[model samples]
Each structure stands twice: as structure tokens, then as C-alpha cells.
Target: MSRIGKKPVPLPAGVTATISGQSIEVKGPKGTLSFKATDDVTLTQEEGAVAVQPRGTSKRARQQWGMSRSMVENLVTGVTQGFKKELDITGVGYRATMQGNVLKLALGYSHDVNYEPPAGVKITTPSARNDVIVVEGIDPQQVGQVAAEIREWRGPEPYKGKGIRYRGEFIFRKEGKKK
Candidate 1:
């Protein structure tokens, strides 16, 4: 038996959840999210809570049951409170600014990089901090995907660390050779 899989996920008020065959959809106060259930897993809802169960007591079923339940849980939370990812610019001259829906990145390059924020994702630069970027959205995967794409524009360099990186992320520096 999977402990996490057996645990019930509480549904909040004004949230609607539906299970049809191998698909589960959760509509919450923030938004709606859906995911496909695993082959060896089944989901049951009762008393405003959802639980996952495996079809058999096999190793694979047990493992997949927990994973499926976690995915469902993430969907619920994503539609409710939503998700956000923060990135920081590390170089001295590197800075980010928003021109309408496009993000202009000046990363010491000859030409500036422009990234258009996708629909449903919000990018905010609250403070004057040169390195701060906040991205928020109801879909966890979309938020993360956009953040990753933005970071890829100028990934942190191992030498001068002149690039975009997630907030609080540690960068490992290599020591120079002895003379």
C-alpha cells in the first residue's frame, strides 16, 4: 500500500472535481486543471476529498499510484493558489525590462534579446532590483516552461556568472590554476 497514494486530498470550497474513466478534472476558485490517471491507478472521491488506489499489490502499481496522486494534487494546488518562478540577473550590465508584453534582456550581447510572455502567464518587475523577475500563472508546467525558456536566453556562465538564474540558486565556481 502506498501511504501518500492512500491519503485523501481535500477539496476546497467552490472547487469542482470530476472523474471520468482515466481522466480527472479539477475546477477550482483560481482555474481548472486536468490530468490523465495512470493505468494501474484509480481515484475515488468522497466527502469532499479525493484518494488514489492501486488496482493490484504489485511493485509497479504501488509506485505509479503515488506518482499519479501527486500529479493530481499538484493540479489542484496550481489552479488554486497558482505557481510562480523567480529569476535573477547576475552580470553587472545584465538587466531585464518589459516593453509591453515583450521582455527585453540586455546581457552584454551585441543585440538585445526579446522574449514575449505567453498568454496566461504574468511577468512582473516589482522593484528596481536589476536581477528580479517574477512569473506567475495557474498552470505550474507553463509557468516553469516560460521561466526555463527565459533563462535559456543567457544561462549563467561558469566564469563571470553573467546570465539569468533562479533566485537563491547557488553557482559553483572553479578555482584558477596555480602560477
Candidate 2:
């Protein structure tokens, strides 16, 4: 039995969910999101919560049951509180700024790097620190993807500990060469 799959996703106040075939749609103040579960699981709404159950006692069915439940839970949370990721830029002259819908970055490169966020996601640089970037969206995956893509441009290096990293991320420092 799947422990997580057994727990129903409680429908919080101001949040609504609908089930159509294998698809579940959740709407809340933040936004509306939908998820389509595999055929091995069944989806339903009871009282003020969403539930997922497997069709049979097979391995795949059990797997889908847990996964489907998690997806539904994520949808609920996403539509309610949304998702956000913060990145900090380190190193001399490393900064990030928003121009319209694009992000302009200066990571010590000869030329500036420009990035355009995909639909439904917003990127911003707070007033206090241009090097601190915040990515917000209703979808957690998209927010994380955007943050990762930005970090890929200038990953933190152990030697100088300079580059883009998560706000609270800790970079391991290695001993430098001592002649």
C-alpha cells in the first residue's frame, strides 16, 4: 500500500477542484492548474478533499497511485501559494536586471547574457540587491527550471566561490595551491 497515496488532498478555503476523465483541474486565487493522471489510477473528490486510488494491485498501478496523489497535492499548493526561487549572484560585476520580460546578466563575460523567461513565469531583481534574483510562478517545475537555467550560465566554482547560487546555498571551499 502507498502511504502518501492514501492521504487525501484537503481542499483549502477559496480553492476548487474538478475532475474530468483522467484529468484534474484545480483553481485558486493564485492560478488554475490541471494534471492528467495515468490510467492505472482513479481520481475522485470527496467532501473537501481529492483522493487517488489504484485500479489493481500491480506495481505500475501502485506507482501511479502515489505519483498521481503527489501531483494533485502540488496542484493544490501551486494554485494557493504559488512557487518561487531565489538566486544570488557572486563575484565582481556579477549582476542581474530585468528589462521588460527579459533578464540581462553580467557575469564578467565580455558580452552581456540575456534570458527570456517562458510563459507564466516572472523574474525580478529586488531593489536592495541587483545580484539577488527572484523567480515566481504558479508552476513549481517552471520556476525551478528557470532558476537552474540561470545558474547554469555561471555555476559557483569552488576556487573563488563566485557565480550564481541559490539564496541559502553553501559552496564548499577547497584549499588552494600553496607553493
The Cα error of candidate 1 at residue 92, in Å, is 1.6
lDDT of 1 at 157: 79
Backbone clash tally (model 1):
0
Per-residue alpha-carbon lDDT of model 1 for 1-179, expressed as tens digits?
A: 77888888888888878999889999988878899987899888889988888999889999989998898889889878999999988888888888888888898889999989888899987759657889999888899999999999889878777788998899887766789
Name the lDDT value of residue 154 in candidate 1.
Answer: 88
lDDT of 1 at 74: 90
* Model 2 deviation from the true structure expressed as Cα RMSD, one decimal place: 1.1
lDDT of each: 0.87, 0.95
| RMSD of each candidate relative to the true structure | 1.5, 1.1
Deviating ranges (above 4 Å) for candidate 2: none
Q: Using Cα atoms with residue i matched to residue i, what is each candidate's TM-score against the true structure?
A: 0.93, 0.96
